[model samples]
Target: MTKKSRRTHSPAFKAKVALAAVKGDKTLAELAQLFDVHPNQITLWKNQLLEGAAGVFG
Candidate 1:
């Protein structure tokens, strides 16, 4: 069997997923399925967004 290549997501896409995660309208699993990304990745993006938000205003 052949190995699958790693996928890279654009910043826009990551921001979209991160925003959805922050909205808390759906579970991580639901968001993962809807966005076709791993739950951990969503969490990472969410944290990154929160962390960087402070810098945006500063």
Candidate 2:
């Protein structure tokens, strides 16, 4: 069997996923399936967005 290559996402895509996560309109599993990404990845991006949000205005 062949190994699958890792995928890379753009900042915009990350932001979109993160925003969806922050909205709390859906569960992580639902978001993951909808966005075709892992739930943990969505959590990571959400944390990153929250951590950096303050910097945008500072």
Candidate 3:
């Protein structure tokens, strides 16, 4: 069986995913399905967003 290659999402796409996580309207699974990515990726982006939020005011 051929292995499926991992796809690279663009920065804009990642930003969109991060924005959706910030909005918190949908669950991680929903975001993952909608964006065609893994839930862990969404969680990672969400965490990154939260971590970087503190720098915006500095």
lDDT digits (tens) for residues 1-58 of candidate 3:
9999989988788888999988999999898899888999998987888898899999
Q: What is the C-alpha RMSD of each candidate to the true structure, in Å?
A: 0.5, 0.5, 1.2
Per-residue lDDT for 10 in model 3? 84
TM-score of each: 0.96, 0.97, 0.83
Off by over 4 Å in 3: none
Alpha carbon lDDT at 1, candidate 2: 100
TM-score quality measure for candidate 3: 0.83
Order of quality (lDDT): 2, 1, 3
Q: Look at candidate 3 and tell me the lDDT of residue 2.
A: 100
Candidate 1: RMSD to truth: 0.5
Off-target runs (Cα >4 Å) in candidate 1 are none
lDDT by residue (1-58, candidate 2, tens digit) is 9999999999999999999999999999999999999999999999999999999999
Candidate 3 lDDT: 0.89
Clashing pairs for model 2 are: none
Which lDDT values do the candidates have, in the order given? Answer: 0.98, 0.99, 0.89
Residues 1-58, model 1: lDDT tens digits: 9999999999999999999999999999999999999999999999999999999989
2 or 3, which is superior by TM-score?
2
